[model samples]
Target: MSSVSRTSPTLATLPVDMVKHITDYLDIDSLWNLACTSKVFMEFIQDLKIRTGGYHVDIQKGSYRIELPAEHYCYCNWEEDDDYLIDDLNKDFKDFQSLFPENIDFLRIDPNLVRNFDRFHQECTVLSIGAHPMEYCRFKAETCPTEKLDLLLNNVNFRKGLALNGPKPLVTENKKIFNIDWLLIRNVTWITPEFIRKLKNKIVYLMGTESLTEKDINEYLKDLKSGKIDNRNLQVIGFNTGFGRPRYDREQVLNGLDTTQVLDQTYKVADYDKRIESELFIGTSSANGDIKIFRSFDFNRDDGTKVSVEFMYRTVRVYIWNQDKEQEKEKVTKKRGHAKDTNGPAAKNPYSHHSSPPPNVYNCGVSRYLLPGNIDYLLIDPKIAGKFKNVMDCAILSIVTFRKGLALNGVIPKMWKIWNIDWLQIRNSSIPIPLSMLYNKIINLWDISTITEPQINRYLLDIRDGAIDQPNLSLIQFRKQSGWNSQEILSGLGTVRCQERKIYKLKDFDEKMRMDTFLPFGLDENGIELRDTFDFVRRKDGVKCSVVLLDWVVRVYVWNQMETKKRARGHPEDKDTNDATAKKSCY
Candidate 1:
């Protein structure tokens, strides 16, 4: 006789949906029970869409997180259990990879009587995440079932920092997430520009958003200037749209906004001392002048508050300043960095102009916001240029060597040389200004005007023959007068042409610039972007340089970057040269 056998149905045998409903009633111990039962159960538990407290547990982040509490994680009773129990548990902990090495001791200790409740509890708090990975409090999945994130965030104090990183899209109706001490949101593309207009966080950084437009940035700045949005607690706020995106047009962002240019080294924002700029741009110094590197625009409010708008390659930062004003006690937030020295007054970088803005101090190294009272930044009066036998070490942004008098009160003007002047404007100046003026100095960009075509020709020829050797000079320009010949400038130089076709962009600040001319004001403003170029090799060191000869100007681009040299495909000698980015890196 055959007997029919009946088998008991377990979670492993049941549908995955049924398994989730059963686990819903289970505690942390129940989870371990199912996970430790067998290989099938372990994977079954892993696949369940369970979110205990803060973390998704579904995945992880490359970012660092603070500690969460360990409320329900009690010590295990290893009396009858084999070493396999602890082994599987340790293996799971290691898989998370968030646990500290010192906190995990199950593997190194004896299995018999090693379940110390107190230490295990402490370790669990370190490993177990609840509200968020970096939050202060802690809880076990058994304590609270998976619920809405808004409800979870609603219960959190958030005096501590907050970070959201989950693979799934978050659904939160709560508006409170917008205002925190410090916050970081990964995959923040869902965030709207409307949300940005309401940001009150002290330091907020939002990543992975392709929807935020430059127009949004312009409106935000306008609001700040109009007092439409005010967050006294706010210190640093930035939006970094990934690379190759449209640049945050400075002219558009600060359009019609009354701004105060900060000339002093300190760009004070409540004395918070968080040097976020340096932390983000750590790789700044080694970089050549391929780009503008740094530029800032600041303004003061009717309420006496100061605001700074800084624009970079493809990113933007808004800094609110209340120098003597204080805010609430600081909380744990994403630390961009801290100021190098804040104890005393800032020391003037003696050689600031001669080198790359000293690493970590690019903020200070960028030319001051420019004194509003000193609007003649372009024209360095010949009288002032004659004062410093050597002001080489000074943080002089641009020099104007026009035939005029300079007004300097403190130092008592004497005699000076043109040393380490970054943006140089020589009005009514000649090609031969004495090698002493250019020798061993860092002059990255130069604009000379009112010079004859013959003089410009002689200068280019001398540069090729090793007669005019300025290693640190990256680019120099000679503006053409009415009678000048553009054709002669391009053909006279022994040169080569590159293949890449492109349009030029020297549009730094606003669009009100005259598109064709390089006026004296152009030195302080922007330069003409269009150009036709030829390459030349310096006889001295076999170094190559690019010369952009335009109908209106003649520009000699030296210190050609190795990347450009290798990538610059040669075109037919008959074809006009391809392109060159303004502010090409210096030697």
Candidate 2:
């Protein structure tokens, strides 16, 4: 019996409200010990979303890569006491989920763990199997069979992405992993060219291919070019030849592919998708950012669809560009007096979706708002705002006057990639940007500088009246208009007050925060702590949220909880919901 052994106490018998308050002071190890006492305590711990930070857990064979909490160090080894490996492996997996943090950043699974794969289907930010992270193939370790891998993967909803490591490449004709968010597979020779062509994932990185020839890659590129395969889902895909395998014969891959000319430039994965950004840069600096340097030759289909094919050291990649987006990139380039990647003028369509990103046109190191498919922060001119309603896909799109805003000269023609934006903040735009033109009504609006109280009232009325459908929308917030109060924001919504003194704080907004700076974006997280707040439940989603009023801003936050021990006990003075600010005495 170790320190984490079950304690004999009915912490579960405590009052519902008291349970959270009491457990909030416990350290991770203490919480683990308490959870072992009862299933009820285990669930309470899990629901708290303790964020247990991130664990690089090795179930067996002795390895632990846990991101330590600021206050404590954790050391609990199951492998150290696996006296009965056969019967207890499945029990051990369940115990891990029950005792530790549920939101693991990286969960390592190996041959031993998968034997009872049917029993557990836990979700993690990244799932590494037989983990192949290096450039070279494992060549001689026991690879997980494709079927056994599928058993666990098919049921789990991997939030950020998926990964397959190669002890020696395993085989699969078709598995659910192919259709997940990402497949960064090492010892990737098992994924055939036909398999690659059919992948429905957003980002695919087959680490090292054994049988993937240039001709096979060309065929896959053709599928993308011809629209035979859905190009929209697969925004980016790449594969390197196996270790000491044939170096890419660029000539062979390029042969018979109608090549569109490209330039010597770079693109960061971070510029495109925030999820992929975190996935790639895990355990690394945000600066190097798992950069996938693409120096490609363009290939166009007969119908004018284009794909960029780039070759690296024994690696090749195909970036599929949306047709309308490719055309608009040219127009935007021409407007800027910037040189285009090709000599020909682009097709004229302001409202087309683009595939590639214009190298993050801002000074790097500014923190990103952790939104999915994040188009990097951009300062777009209002003059071009009418052009496709300035349809740029970004987590934060800060609007500024053309003279005030700077657009970096991109070597490759830049276009709007129409992925969903999580936030849009408008600061200096003079003209009225229509709500409809804002695409999906811009999930969480921020600036609303020009927005009138009546307009906001109508927007809220529409949601309550079922005139609008915004399921993805978690919140709508802004700095209060002169003389506006929480009453004005919730006029017809008929909200109720849930708690007054319970001032919970949510700091997920730290570094992971607040984007969408065009009109206004809601930095309102689901895990918002509220004091003197009003609560409302959506009739449609049954989701509850709160409206918090301050001197300057009125925030409509989708009511959720901060991790148990993270609740702050003080007066709330700032809008950021930072726990530290609440504790610091202004006097």
Candidate 3:
């Protein structure tokens, strides 16, 4: 008894990674045996417990399932050691009780587990109590009372949620539990205005029960839209009539929640000193992606056409935040050097800058840009929204288009919403105009008084002969204006890759181009859209040269097939960078 015996080689002596690897293949019994060896091993098992989201127990059935870290069922097979298993389970329950005092993100309860409910109630943010069986049990020779359901509903321990199979009247016994974050109520017939008024959750899914009235539904929607519900965290709500579609209040529920609207604010040309920075914002209609819209802004060259911008983004939901005074100062400080102009204050010559070129330069021939002050409204267009399947497909189309100089300029509305990747096969019905072609001019006609044909020809020839890159693109008429300057208004030239054939696959060309069958617009003799189609036979070292003709101006695009799809239109990360930089400036 006095002699000390050395313990056998402990697995803890192995490296942590090795220990983890070995433990991964062990059964529940083996792991438990190892855990029993030392406190260190028990801690390691607890790590696995956390990673696997702990155990899920069916208290009534007296059954437990270990949830693996991967969210799959644990690979461990059950051993017939009932005594050992019960002991370990009790230990685990006690361990969790000691670990979480504030709340567990998710918890499930059954009648058998009600004894410990009080001790663990504070740790659960989501609680699910199994619906009591109502069907007549032949073995019992009687129908079960609603005692279990009553107990579940009246349980005071559940903090955030009490999932019910159907809605029930208020229980005075418990006087309601914690603020409900998830109300998965079926048979919504019991739901009333008063019931909805007291409900608080980020997500509410109502099913069955036709007891709800139009007025009560309207009040519910009104409260939801005004952020009076959900602790101001509501992100999604779903309604199902459980029969045919139920009719209730429409107006407030439809357009009341952040309906898209533009505030009364005029965009001055001089306000954008540097070339206009155009951006695209994208949003979805629901958490399930029932609709999506791409919103963008385009300014004219001379800044004369201020009326081009509109406010709408298909079926997408939007949230426009107005920058406070302090935010404006932060923005200015962050984008200091990017302004690129020091002439005068924008207030002095608000209309000095040139507007964008004519409507033909853009797709849809409509500019729906929203200024910062005007972005306070949101919209979820019913007309544009569809089933989740179609919405996901549209999202994919939007993303693929974005990679090709099309960009995303906005954020999704909530956390639970997800973009469906399988829906990418559906192509866009509208052809997107390249933003490069939209912005960063080689030469602006509004900046010059006059540019002659021969000079344009020489400039084009130089670009063709490789002496100068393609340049001098404008929409201005050389002879129409009075002022004449002999010197050429030549900005530095840049090259764009020309291709022998159209590079990527272009689907839905007819629908996207909106081709007129009888009287075609912008179509060549072959009926191809001339602006997007071009061919050049002139080859220097087997490279063809093509040019874009805009009124009296010419912009050449150098043929490079490899670089065709490599252009950076813009990126979603640009917004993040801009935001981070703005925030950093504040700091």
- Candidate closest to the true structure, highest TM-score: 2
User: How are the candidates ranked when ordered by lDDT, highest leading?
Assistant: 2, 1, 3
What residue runs in model 1 are displaced by over 4 Å at the alpha carbon?
1-148, 151-158, 165-176, 260-264, 268-294, 327-587
Candidate 3 per-residue lDDT over residues 223-289, each given as its tens digit: 5444454443333344544422333434433333333333543322112112111000111122222
Task: Report the backbone clash tally of model 3.
Answer: 25
Displacement of residue 304 (Cα, Å) in model 3 is: 30
Q: Which of 1 and 3 is the better model by lDDT?
A: 1
The lDDT of each candidate is 0.42, 0.49, 0.33
Residue 219 Cα positional deviation in candidate 1, in Å, after optimal superposition: 1.8
- Which candidate model has the greater lDDT, 2 or 3? 2
Worst 10 residues of 1 by lDDT: 105-114
lDDT (Cα, tens digit) per residue for candidate 2, span 32-131: 7778787788787777655333444444333333433222234433443333442354454456555543345456565445555665465666676664
Number of the candidate with higher TM-score, 1 or 2: 2
CA displacement after TM-score superposition, residue 426 of candidate 3 (Å): 21
RMSD per model, one decimal: 25.6, 24.7, 26.9
Candidate 2, residue 341: the lDDT equals 13
TM-score of each: 0.32, 0.43, 0.34
lDDT of 2 at 409: 16
Q: lDDT of candidate 2?
A: 0.49
